[model samples]
Target: MQQLFKNYINTFRGLSKEIWWLALITLINRAGTMVIPFLSLYLKEDLHFTVSHVGWVMSAFGLGSVAGSWLGGKLTDMFGFYKIMIWSLLATGFLFIALQFINTFESICIGIFIVMMVADAFRPAMFVALNAYSKPENKIRSLTLIRLAINLGFSAGPAIGGLIITGLGYAGLFWVDGLTCIIATLVMINVLHPKKAKVLDEIKNEYPISAYKDGTFLIFLLAMALFGIVFLQYFSTITIYYKDIHSLSELQIGLILGLNGLLIFIFEMPLIKWLENTTYTKLKLMLFGVVLTGLSLLVLNLTSWSGILIAGMILMTIGEMIAFPFSNAFAVERAQKGNQGEYMALYSISFSIAHIFGHNAGLQMTYKFGFDITWYLVALVAFVCAIILYFLNKKLKTITN
Candidate 1:
């Protein structure tokens, strides 16, 4: 056990101190990420909206994410990540608090949209910061470390969110969520501010708009969009599945989701570290991950037993651990130094587009066809996407090499 623990520490040993601080910031921010995971439930249970209305609310959040990612990238390139990161954190915090007052359907949709827009804007800047602080060989592990922090924080968020919901209601969830965002913003102000400023200056020194023109990247973006649509269902559609189909309460839903984070936190970093030494290409690893994702979703159709949900969640989390960091690494490696923000922004947008279509469309399909058929369809989409990504990765290697 001691040696195993030592190996895990060794996996993360050599990253720059700034990278650690960045991971800390991610931890603090995501620790309060209570609102979104439960937002669909909140809208349904508290606001008494139908499942279709819940889809629209999630889709609205996705739309804001799209705008924020685009605008954040442009601003990060122009002004540097430091200023953009700080403001985004502060704004998202305030917006979470604002969501409590919105009671009407239209009002709720607009509020959720604005909050996601402001909150998601933080992503591109954070990616840029990761790139700036880490060495080339360490990039994937650095991303893994950050992801581990996020998972750890997320593990806490939902479990605690469940308790808060039981005791203080949904409004209390927002206050705590917002307060953590503000706390993270202060950490950025005091701890990460001065050190990351030089990295931001370096980012600003080169500015290229060619990420839009890269054909390989465009195909990669498409693949990401498809995968995101499948993966994000866990966030939007699956919560509904748990509540409506399985008849679980909000606290039960939180525990199940929290299980996903707990598994990732325990396994992701070590797995990625081990992968670093393997002969596997990034695409191969990604293909494996995507396949697991399809299997995870398809398993639901095979069984109605709630215990099977754990199996499905495990598969999904494993797939995430394998796929997401490598995908980010591929983008970073392919991007020109001056345009990291732009490339990362486009990458962020893929998930946002998923948000736009995945939930709204997913719910509509489920409402029409039922969960079994809907999940089967999602599995099929994953299968097709994996095939495309496999070929595209081969083609990209030929082009780049």
Candidate 2:
């Protein structure tokens, strides 16, 4: 136990000091997000909305995320991450808090969407700004640490959210989640400032993000959108599969999903070390993830064993860890120095698009097709994603090298 504890501390120590702030910020953000994982549940269970109405709410959130994705980079570039962040926290917090009062399905759906867009707008800004500030030597390490914080919060958030819902009910959970964001904003106010790094100047001095405008960035975004379609299926449709087919509880689902993020927390850095200095190879590695993910989905339909599901989740996590970092590294690596925020913002759009399809259309498709068909469809999507990346990899390699 002592040896294990020591090793754990040292793993974190391997990251740059800047990551400590990221870890803290991620925790605060995740804490604020306590409302997120259980949001669909809140809508269905508390507000008693029809499934279609729930879909609209999810759509609204996705729309907001899209807006944020487009604007986040420019805001970071213009106003700086600090100022925009301030606005994002307050906006999201109020939106979350406001949801507590709505009894109507339409109001809940439309209102939350607007709130989500406003709140989520701050996300990429934080990501890009921190990426801009950190030393290049630690880019992968820093990103890994950030992902770790997000997972840690993710791991904890649902369990806590459920507990709050159980005890104080959904409104209580919403209020708490909102407060958490408000607090994170306060801490962030100190972490970023009114005046700070001149991102444009830094780009000129170091790895220029602008150099990536050669079109590889657009290709990367295309692949990301495709991959995201497959990835988002986990949240939107998989839950129904577990509950309807396997009779799994919310706790069980949380544990299953948490496994993916947990594996990433443990192995992401070492994996990156093994793949060192080659973001282009991420395309191929992500294909392996695609297969594992496909396998994971298959396991759910093919078997009824609880242990088997857990095992499949572990494999899926490995695939996620493998693919996500490489994708991020490739995009950032190819970006022009000054345009890191813009690039990250553009990449974020893929996930937003994915979420939109995943929750809305993906859910409808899953409901109609069933798991056997859904898993197969998901696998086909993964294969297509791999194919797209393969062609992009060929071109990206030439440009990068």
Candidate 3:
């Protein structure tokens, strides 16, 4: 056991200090991620928006995310990751504050769109920064470390957010979230300057054609997008399910959802390390992750028992551990040296597309078809995604080998 623990630590030993600070920045930013988790609930409950209306607003956020991701990637390649990230973080802070004051449906929709656009632009820039800071060999482990930080903060965020919402209501959530962004931005500006100052100049001249022209990668994107649609339900429709169907309070729902992040935090790093030694390829593990995600949703519908709910959540978290980081590493591997931002941006766009399907379609389906059928539909989607990913991986492996 001691040796195993030591080996796990060794996996992280080669990574640079910048990677560690990046993880810290991620943790600080995510720790205040209270607003999005409960956005549907707030819109439905406080603003008296219908479920469909909530879905529309959320989809608007998704649309903005798509635009933001594409623009962020281009901007990162042009202006560099540092300025892009700093502006994204600070702009997101201001938007969050602005969102609190918007109560009308049209106004809130516009607010959500702008907020998401500004906030989500940070993602591609962050990934680009990660690529610049870490060595190629340490890439996967570095991404895992950052995800570990994210999940750890996620574990805390919603729990604290739940308490805040219960005591002070939704406005408090926005204020706290906004303040955290500012703090993260301050840290980035004052303490953590870029180690790879030449990254901008290095990649500036090596422009490639559009990612859409790459057929294999496009297929991979489609498969991953389907997986993302299913994976994102935990954020979108599941909250409503717990509230309406299970009659759980916000605090209980937050705690239950927080369990996913807690499990990921505890197990993901060690699991990634273990997988490194095993014969299983990253794609195979990701396939298993997708299958587990389907099973997680299926498991939830099997019974109304609380234990079953927790069990399903555990399975979903395990799926996340297996799939999400590896999928990212795969994208990074696929990119040409100078075009990492564009590839990562395309990957980000896939998840943004998922928000459209996962939120609008999910909520609409639940409203019309009920949770059982909706969940089964999502499960079937995951199963199909796994199959597609399997073939795609084999193709890539053959090409590389």
Using lDDT as the measure, which candidate wins? 1
Per-residue alpha-carbon lDDT of model 2 for 243-289, expressed as tens digits?
Answer: 66778766667666666666776777667666765653767876676
TM-score of each: 0.96, 0.89, 0.95
Candidate scoring better on lDDT of 1 and 3: 1
Q: Clashing pairs in model 1?
A: none
- Clashes in predicted model 3: 0
Report backbone clashes per prediction: 0, 10, 0
Query: Distance from true position, residue 140, model 3, in Å?
Result: 0.2
Q: Candidate 1 residues 1-401, lDDT tens each?
A: 99999998888888888889999999999999988788888888898999899889889989999989988888888887888899999988888887898889899888888888888889998888888888767889888999999999988899899999999999998998899999999987888865544452233434465788887788888988899989988987899999888998888989999998899888898999889899888988988899999889999988789988889999999999999989989887766544877888998998899899988988888889999999999998899889988899788679779
Structure candidate 2, residue pairs in collision:
64-117, 208-336, 208-337, 209-335, 209-336, 209-337, 209-338, 210-336, 210-337, 211-336
Candidates' C-alpha lDDT: 0.87, 0.70, 0.86
lDDT by residue (tens digit), candidate 3, 1-401: 99987866776788777788889888999998888889999999888899999899889888889888988988987887889999999989878977899899899878888888888888899998888777877888889999998998889888888899899999999998999999999988876676544342123334565667778878989988999889988887999998998898999988998888898877888889888779877788899999999899998888887678888898999999999988988887766543767888898999999987788888999999999999999999999999998998898789989
Question: Candidate 2: TM-score?
Answer: 0.89
After TM-score superposition, the amount by which residue 380's alpha carbon in candidate 2 deviates from its true location, in angstroms, is: 1.4
TM-score attained by model 1: 0.96
